[model samples]
Target: MKYQFFWITVLLIFSLSACKSIQEKANDQFLSGQYQYAINSYSQILENEPDNLEANQAVAESYRLSNRVEQAGPYYEKLVEEEPTFENVYRLGLSLKAQQKPAEAKAAFEKAKGYTQNETYLAETQRQIEAINLSEGIEDYFPNYELVNYTELNTAGADYAPVISENFMYFTSGRRASGIYPADGSPYTKLFRTRAEGLRVDVGNIQTLPEFQNEEGLNQAAIAISPDGNTIIYARGNSTSPKDLPETALFASYFRGAGFTQPIWLPVNEDETWWNSTPAFSPDGEELYFASNRPGGFGGIDLYKATKLANGDFGNAVNLGPNVNTPGNELFPRMTADGKFFFSSDGHPGYGKLDLFVAEKGADGNQVIKNLGENFNSPSDDFGIFFSNYPKEGFISSNREGGAGDDDIYFFEDKTPKPKIVNVLLNVFTKQRVAGEPDAVLEQARVVLYDSSNDQEGGDFSNSNGRVRFTLEPNADFTIIASKGGYFSKSIPYTTRGKTPNPEDLIQEVTNITLDTTIVLDQLILDKSIVLENIYYDLDKADIRPDAAVELDKLVQILKDNPSIKIELSSHTDDRSSDEYNQDLSQRRAQSAVDYIVSQGISADRLVAKGYGESQLIIENATTEEEHQTNRRTEFKVIEIQE
Candidate 1:
């Protein structure tokens, strides 16, 4: 019995000493930020003592920090099952949740509540339940589209920005075959075209543009095609030519039967100085909208528009206004088939980096822009949105995981409900009375209406008589503002709500308004900036009401005398809704305004419609109705005047 006791003591001492050595090693590794190594050490200890709670928990924690949720699940489950402690179970639930097993996570959290009797843990479990509920209906947002095929084109270092037309797919690539050497003699990025055969899903017969090849340091991106696909406009960066600096000017070239014609630069008038690129053409091919970083703009890069005169010259570029251009960078403007605008932005709050967005005209002619949410966007960069109207197919490029390459092209069919039409009319009033005319008749007096809900959507002007009318979609609200060159701007508020229909229904109405001429005349004489009342909108809608029309008529008059004047119609809205909803509504509102003007005899080609949505809200917060109202509005600025 004495000998047996002596052997047992020795064995006990060796076992305890081994554990201490292992623990010390793990502590050193964990404190040094060697998480993986620490995990290995803790795992070794847990193997010796299966119920070593501390060691098991540490293993789970290290796995989580490494973003290896799948690897941590078993250990967390074991820790929680063996000891139903609040900390153990709570952490175990988190691990399950990270692995996307919300049901199992909720169950684990519920079990934990019994162990600690802590209200905080119970409350957290309820929150998790709510989040799971919200995620339940999420699958509907992802449409069912067949992945035709995934083909490895060339072993290009970085290939992206694939845009498809009738028979060709245009893209930018940094590949050795591009023949464009980088500044350091490496492969530089260049534009390439390939035949897109019957949607085979593989790039075929890739060819490079000779004119854009082998440049030392120039980078070209964001290409836009004309409606007829005869002209191409793209952004060229790092240009040595001084003329290219001031106006990120867009160049144009006709398509000869054989190939593209020599490129010619299109410069904006000297008055509007800025860096402009990423040109998007209207369906009629008479207007061009592009991104610019210019002074007097809201901030960052804003979208601007210019019209092509009968003489084949583009008029001066006009800023899209505060609604569409925010302090954030708004880029990749593309016009949809129904005349709405779409783009991408990082400034707007979204699921992640540079999600896709849409802007539309509201009944009051304002731009309302919004972000497309999680179903389409991920934590990675989601951008380069393009859609084909007839077949109703589109493509988006993303750098998210589980893609074919670093950046993969995702094809989708728009399954979300379409926008509804909501319309409003307004009567204009001015302080100065015209001789032999009623107070309403301000000849050529401009009235501007903004869809306060979605700024990127609604933007319009009045006719010869100070009267304006526009349309908007349902599920939105707006603010109205009216202004003349020598008159103060006037404002009003409105709202709309209802379940959106399959194809949104259109609503119409009218309101009468009067402007204070004293404020306008005084500010003009003093050369002080006239402060226009801010407009507002609901979560995602861009419809205008009678109140919005009053402001739109003021803008109409501004365009009449400046017959040489060309302006960009911009819309904006608040940030309370899903990005896709806001984008679609904003776009509809913008198109609604352009439609109204064309009906009133403004050349259909003269006015341009652009939507920035919530990406360009004037007010940062929407805590109050007033602040929300400030975010929704529409406005216009002169881009050019033909002498």
Candidate 2:
């Protein structure tokens, strides 16, 4: 027994020693910023101890830092299922969303929502859910862009973020001849410049900048040029050696005849440890845009704008605010020469990780951010965008399926042939219902149009001709409400489905298509009973049926539309049951209906329930069932008009 015990103890000791060795190595690699090596080292520990929380967390973070969050889903799921902590679950949701599993991601986010008291985390969770909803069916709309991979400019490594100034195009590429980076297992990246005409570039002429900017043992990428092509800034750092401290920040250089000046680290990066990259200059060169993960940001990384101070220095970096930044990373911000702003974000709710979007001035002059939709965004990382024209042509970078490298540059043009616009105008005529005569035009009636989502589109008062007109967009559903003083309001549903002329069919540059409709409002008359149809109770029962509830909802709407009107709800019975019993049952039914209306937000003080049993039957002597049904009825009429 002693010999057997000794052998088992030796084996156990060997296994534990191996696991400790691997754990120590992984921790070393993780702290030194070699996440890929750390991932492999930590994974070995997981093979022996799958529930090792430290190993699991490091491995998942490694994948995210390497820009492969799509592959971190399984590890994140394991972490969340084991711990169910807010951070774990929230990260799991992001991983799932990066994997294009939005539904599962949304559920994970909702679960994480219940576990946090942090306002920022809670707001981020809700934003993620909204993003999932906003991204649903995002591709089923009109597509306007046509993209082409610039094959001559690509290599087997990543080649992305192209910017043009004067006659040269500058970009970052991983084709630099060097040892592979341990983080992503790719060669070190450097900024390269080449002669180019729009989408056509001379790859043979490509060359790196001075050795100062393309320093050894660092990854220099994401280059941008100033409007005059005299100033250049690029993101640099992320040491290739474990002995060096790791960082990513912006560095700038200015033109000096044949060669540029020695690259100087920009002062806009106030914190060295905070991650700042993707620098861009505004068209006027008065403002600089970049992405950072500094403190007080709403997300993992946010876009910031820094204004140029006097004497040619930049400072006072300001976050783009919540309108343009969300709970996820926002990167690669750029502006066009024509004043249109664009950027890439994972927070804005789009096709997948890092989709392209644009921010513009709305009708109210507020910032309006809109997704570029499926045309420019894909189910993969699509970012590093620049536009040569205002809204027509641009170049974008992505790692989508057909790309030649990790992230390839593609030229895109708005090839949606400019369509002959057809104006769709809806004119509404408001008329009053006159007793025993044709309806008369009603002036000064309020008409409002709402879209399918119940958002008000337009509103106007009827003019001297009793007409209200609204311009309609193509393929929309609308609700038109007409209201006038001392009259019952009315709502009409309108649709323009299948009514738009196809672009191919339109010949004129502009076409006017007009449609007309009429709305008739009833003049309120006191004590005139309006029968509430389809409100029937079971025989001898006083409970309100589901059908009766449906009819009462109409009365509830009427009460809401005319706030100053009060009504009396009456119930009647046939001359079949005993007078006393019939009176009690009828009164109960009327009260049940009144209770239902009250439940729908109508005030009880504005309603009165009355029962007229066999004492006041509509049919004095009912013989057939139809006559009984007519006699046994419920109705409501205006009793008091406070207006």
Q: Which candidate is the best by TM-score?
A: 2
The local distance difference test score of each candidate is: 0.61, 0.86
- What tens-digit string does per-residue lDDT give for candidate 2 at 60-103? 99998888888888888888878889988888888888888888
- Count steric clashes of candidate 1: 92
Error of 2 at 603 (Å): 61
Top lDDT hit: 2
Candidate 2, poorest ten consecutive residues by summed lDDT: 136-145
| Clash count for each candidate, listed in order shown | 92, 0
Q: Write the per-residue lDDT of candidate 1 for residues 380-482, one digit (tens) a residue.
A: 5677766644335666777666665555666666454543433333343334443365444444444454565436444445556445554544456655555
